[model samples]
Target: MLGNLFRAETSTLQDPSDELWDALCGPQSAAGKVVTADTAMRVAAVYACVRILSETVAALPFNLYQKTAKNNREVASKHPLQMLLHDLPNEEMTSMDFRTQLMAALQLRGNAFSEVERDRAGRVHGVWPINPDKVWVGRSEKTKRLSFEIHDGDMRTLTPQRMWRVAGLSTNGIIGLSPISQAREGIGLSLALEEHGARLFSNGAKPGGVLQVEGKLSDPAYARLRKSWSDRHQGGANAHRVAILEEGTKWNQIGMSSEDAQFLESRKYQRSEIASMFGVPPHMIADLEKATFSNIEHQSIQFVVYSLLPWLKRIEQSIFRDLLSPVERREYYAKHSVEGLLRGDSKSRSEFYKNLFNSGAISINDMRRLENMNSIDGGDQHWLQLAMAPITQSREPSSSGSSND
Candidate 1:
């Protein structure tokens, strides 16, 4: 049934439209650099942001959980879907590799696609990632339902059930807008600045200065003088070298302007901007200008809460919606364990665990499990402070009806 539903057709010989051609060629930024997902990643900040987000998500523990009879939830370790998601997504890739690829796609292209391969019983057996660039999303006019057109070797159509999609921020719910395409101008400017700096250094790290002479020289003499100067002191290796002046010629050095001096500052600001574009904290990408020892920990917490939480929720919900069947959805859901990212220093964590243990909120075994330590034989029992009493009991008069001597 699944094979029949997915129909493939060979492409017909036709000229591509201008829009299609432009997409194939990629967008040219104002800085003259071609800005695509692949090209944007060449920028250091862009690469760092994507790598941080993708690898962070990939390292997290993602697994399916089932609702228990006691109204709690537990990891469905034996479930086929659980094993597929937590250990391996497909034969070709481990769960981390698959998740990292999909997340990187989401960070770069604003969308990720995966084909859901099901067994004879309609249980999901494997998941295979598809390149976002090769898949086009559209709604069918007849049913008004979403469909995916995969442009691999053959043009194949996949129904919503057969294809899993995770989209980033979007104006419409169907298609996600590419961050690289939207922020091309700023990224292009960064690229241009980087290139300019490289060229400036290559030209001896100084602006072209005027050469004063006693009298006007012929064109050939001027040409010969210019070529001689360039050949002696054009590259970084020849920078700051002593020059011999003859024939009453004088070298007037040009000092760098304020704007030129601020080139490094501009590059730093652009790095911050790129980090902000991906919702990453500047300190996370090694931008510690405003970060301090006192507040860097707080910033890391903010990164997990403000930046990483939304992406985690998005992926978790998408998995629940696209991977689970209607009946399975009622009882099972997916989640990523963010405990490790949110964990504080040893002192802070010890205090936290102490408070929770005293309040009987968590058992010793639970804390051990969170710390990835082996549980003791009797660590399952929850403990509470024995001296703590209810407010009403504290307010009551003594039964002996006498004051303490």
Candidate 2:
């Protein structure tokens, strides 16, 4: 299935033009740094946000589900595409690896593409990821349908059926805008600040300070003094070393500049800003300055709701649209099980289950399944408290008491 997609039998597809390469090179930012998706990753905050989101999404239980007659859904374990999605997307990559790479690409570039390979019977067999850099999206002039031009040693055009795309937030509904491109100024500034801090420490953590002498010295003496000072104090290894002055030379120390002091604060702000841009909570990325025990759990929940849910929905909807045939779409759908992420502490979870069980909203077997425990026999029956009754219902008069009254 994979071999047929890469065969060099293409004729009409054109090579990607130089204009596309220039765009891919990315734009220069206000901080005077080029902020491409690759370069933006060098910033620690960007890397952390991407890693948190991608890993979290990849670790989730992505499964194909079938709608049952009872209005409930069950894992489509017997479906052929179920194995492709749940265990392996292709021969070369496991589900986790494939999802991680695809999600990282979506997070960084705002779009991810994979070629869907189907067997002769029109059943999906494998899915192979294509680098966003190598794929170009366009619409046909006559049909006005979306097409993807892929350049992997050979150019090939694929229709929407063969190409699966998971797009992030989009304005045009056709293509997703890259977050790295949209937030280049902030990210570039972060990269520049990081570079500046590195350079500051690389020079023995000393901004240039003046050395005083009692009298004027010759050019050779001055040169020797400068060389001697650098030899003794330069580089991070020599930082904070005590210097011995000779020949009545006095060392005048320079205080840290205002900009340097603000460097730390600026970096902190940028970290929070980048996290916000990615819809990740500050606590998730270890930015807990304002985080407290009271709100950290809520923040984590918000991360799953506000940050991860949208991305998961996009992937799920894309899977339903791209992987399943028109006939199968009505019956089968893709979903990620986020029940684990949304679970609270053990005590809280116990209370939740208790409430649901008492209300007969969930049975013992359902609770056990949620907790990943084997269900007990006859545990599927739902039960509610028999004593519970509506407030408007009056108690029935006792049969023997009616005569006594």
Candidate 3:
């Protein structure tokens, strides 16, 4: 089934155009393509359809093969895969086929699929393989013959040394776009994916380290460690989470006298300094020092990350597991729904939030402050995404009278 779509889409493959060659250089190329203005319009429509389908399908239990999870009774039987299963239930139709069609739609729109991954922290991270968005940083390579500049949008290099960036895949290591490729800029690239953007899994992603990312792991050996950490941390599923919290609280009681006080009170501890502080993990310092609050962008990132640390891995699994029970799946749906409502507007203003009474991730007020901090960079189309992005919201309380629910 997928083969047909691939054949049909590339059926007209003439020699690759210079424009096409330049566009699909590396990791940013995954977004696909947009040949005509009409293709853009069609792809926009398809993009929406695909997103809805992706979410619905992402939530399905594998054996059921129904993305709606026995609940979306009136979804009108959407999704090509769902329909294929419903009508034919034959071996011919495969997910590869669905993917081919999706890729065609993306290519038609001039977008490429670059890799994306969620970290153990449930923070979204990704690199551009062929970005029409051009939000990714451009790497400059000066050759003796000519200076060919590569950005996230360009992936395939004429030269062997050019990097093979992957889009739509969860990559942790910075893609080797070029010797001049900026890792920090790639970190900014990672920041672009926003909240649940990363496709990684691990309990500990200390952002402060001088990251020497070589590649992204579609599946890693430590994936289970991330699961273990995430359940206890992200979903409150950890067997020892209670013990960790108790120990943490006990340590917090005496402030500077605490055993972990070393993480906080040193003369050099400052928010801007955390990223550069040699070996200290940013989260450790953020929790102990709480000094990142001074910088709005950093503060929100700190809070959002800190708030979700325990649950990161769990959220990572929850975000894409086809194994959730119907009830469990619905809960995920409802929570994201409310978050979506908040996020869709892209302009929620509040000093802090009082949520998370149940998750026990952090104190409600503290969580709110984190939310306020994270809201700095707007334009997340959904709420949980807003939860991940930097907020420009103030530390002052909200007057919008949003329901606590």
Candidate 4:
């Protein structure tokens, strides 16, 4: 038990030039000892965000910072494809999709535009058939400034995540992150206004990270901008869980065999319809489909085994200084194996998981593992360590004792 408190070698996440996609997706290899289950999960979530960004950006605009319907109000977003998003599962929109969309939206805020492309010589340029608004083909002056300010906001919030989604970017794959850790990823999003760099208080410096800044726009416009950015970038623990997917309900919104249709149908452990309360994309819901589930029955056992499970081991290793680690969390022939990772014949996910639970009670290690798995990425990581820091022993009691001493 005491052995669980390990420290991984603190590795800096390097920015691979032209390899932002590679970095966002993940590094080709990793070495440091994984520190703790909590840190492990955060690291994994961070990777997930990175992968979301890498993949989404490479994939394009579909999922970045989509709008969602609040309350009983019917959903509609700024994107022309708003109607399509409103019909998606709420989980898809608010969580995974929401995360990706936030990154994409940040990218857009920093540099969104609708226009034809031209070369330096000012020769004729080809017109893109796609709608200019949906495509993040380039950045605008205002948008760039906003993007920088948004990154500023991230540092100010002191939260590690900076993600986005934009409805106009792509037809699928909604989320993205920068230097991702699960609870949130630190997004180094491309902003529109680079001219006024690092102007926190300097004159003529414009704020990029803010939805609204002092002296930028009128109160009404600023109010709308603030609300819009909030809807676009909201995540973390404070984020509301829009809805949970239920078993036996199929999300057949995109029709059979289409890419959208194939995504949700792949979650074989259970079936459910999730309306994207947020006006994001169908694929966004599918991105982190399994992570949000509270119940074991409908949990993304397969995804946990493949993508997320490794994180736990990494955490355990780094935390405990790399002792007694599993080669991988899921078995090759196990029941919940998905098409991508597993080696052979598959069984029902529940049946596969049931065999592991045959032992009636949970292990001490399992509880520890779960505790770390469920930990958030922000200050909680330091709460215990900070509380236990050593202090100087007092040579004299320097208290007035309420002035009655």
> Model 2 — TM-score against the truth?
0.86
**Prediction RMSDs, each to the true structure:** 5.4, 5.2, 25.7, 31.6
lDDT over C-alpha atoms for residue 3 of model 1: 28
lDDT of 1 at 279: 92
- Give the least accurate 10-residue stretch of model 4, judged by summed lDDT: 186-195
Residue 88, candidate 4: alpha-carbon lDDT: 34
Q: Give lDDT for model 4.
A: 0.28
| lDDT at residue 218 of model 4 (Cα atoms) | 67
Question: At residue 379, what lDDT does model 3 achieve?
Answer: 29
- Runs of candidate 3 with Cα error greater than 4 angstroms are 1-161, 164-355, 373-405
RMSD of 4: 31.6
lDDT of 4 by residue, 1-405 (tens): 111112132211222241353335442223222222123222322233334433333222222132234522222244222322222313224223432443333332221221223345432122112221232211224333112112212221111112111222222222222212221111111010111122312312212232213344668965775575445434343243342323332222222322433432433211112112112222333545444434432333343354333432322222122111143222111111122223222455335334433443433343334334553334222111123333565355667655653
Candidate 2 accuracy as lDDT: 0.86
What's the CA error at residue 397 for candidate 4, in Å?
94
TM-score for each prediction? 0.86, 0.86, 0.18, 0.17
lDDT of 2 by residue, 130-223 (tens): 9987777766656767778888888788988898999888877767778997898999999998887787777687776788999998999999
Which is the winner by TM-score between candidate 2 and candidate 3? 2
Best by lDDT: 2
Better of 2 and 4 by TM-score: 2
Model 3, residue 228: distance off in Å is 81
Q: Any runs in candidate 1 off by more than 4 Å, and if so which?
A: 1-26, 209-227, 245-261, 390-405
